[model samples]
Target: MKINVKLFATFRIGRGKIVYLDYYEGMTVKNIIDELGIKKEEIAIIIVGPHDGTPEKMLTFKVEPNMTVHLFPPVAGG
Candidate 1:
């Protein structure tokens, strides 16, 4: 299955607005993070809803075939 991943702020370094990743059945958010070499501490926010909801762990979190996952890095504004 494939899911849509969105990266924000510093996390968007070499990546564009969104990316599609392939995973096998019964894959969890944790699996995808590991596969992409991303550490939990690096993410500031993790969401399953579109532009809403609380941040959570992707590793233990489960996602469906077409779910949209949003990730952001810690940000500070003056």
Candidate 2:
């Protein structure tokens, strides 16, 4: 299966803004993060299956093919 990943904020510093990758069935958000060499703490939030509904939890959410997964880094401001 293939999925489209979008990176934002700090997560996009080194990596590009978007990428297309291959994944197997039952692949969780953690699996993608691990594959990208991103530490769990590095990502503040993840949204799967478009921008509707709730964001998927990193550890337990299985990513489906053809879905758009957006990764965001921690937001800090005064």
Candidate 3:
């Protein structure tokens, strides 16, 4: 299965480009994060299939084959 990953804000700055990741059918957001080597500090927001997603739960959010995962950095502003 392949998932579309979009990196935003500082996450993009560090990663250089968005990515398409391939994994087994049962893979979750945490699995992708581990495979991509994304640091915990670099991630602020994670949205999967129109709702808030959790990274620590591992399989909490079940991703469909070819689903788009959005990654955003922590907002910093006055």
Give the TM-score (vs. native) of candidate 2.
0.82
How much lDDT does each candidate structure score? 0.73, 0.75, 0.73
Per-residue error (Å), model 2, residue 55: 9.2
Question: Compared with the true structure, what per-residue lDDT tens digits does model 2 show for residues 1-78?
Answer: 688889997777777898778979888777877777788777677888653222345556878888878888777888
Clashing pairs in 1: 29-58, 30-58, 30-59
Could you report the Cα RMSD, in angstroms, for every candidate shown? 2.5, 2.6, 2.3
Error of 1 at 23 (Å): 3.5
**Alpha carbon deviation, residue 21, candidate 3 (Å):** 0.6
Measured on C-alpha atoms, candidate 1 has an lDDT of 0.73
Predicted structure with the largest TM-score when compared to the true one = 2
lDDT of 3: 0.73
Residue pairs with backbone atoms closer than 3 Å in model 3 (clashes)? none
Query: Which prediction has the highest lDDT against the true structure?
Result: 2
Cα deviation of 37, candidate 2, in Å: 0.9
In candidate 1, position 60 carries an lDDT of 68
Q: How does residue 33 of candidate 1 score in lDDT?
A: 64
Residue 54 of model 2, lDDT score: 28
Candidate 3 per-residue lDDT over residues 1-78, each given as its tens digit: 689888877666656568888857778787777776786566777888777744554335768888888877678889
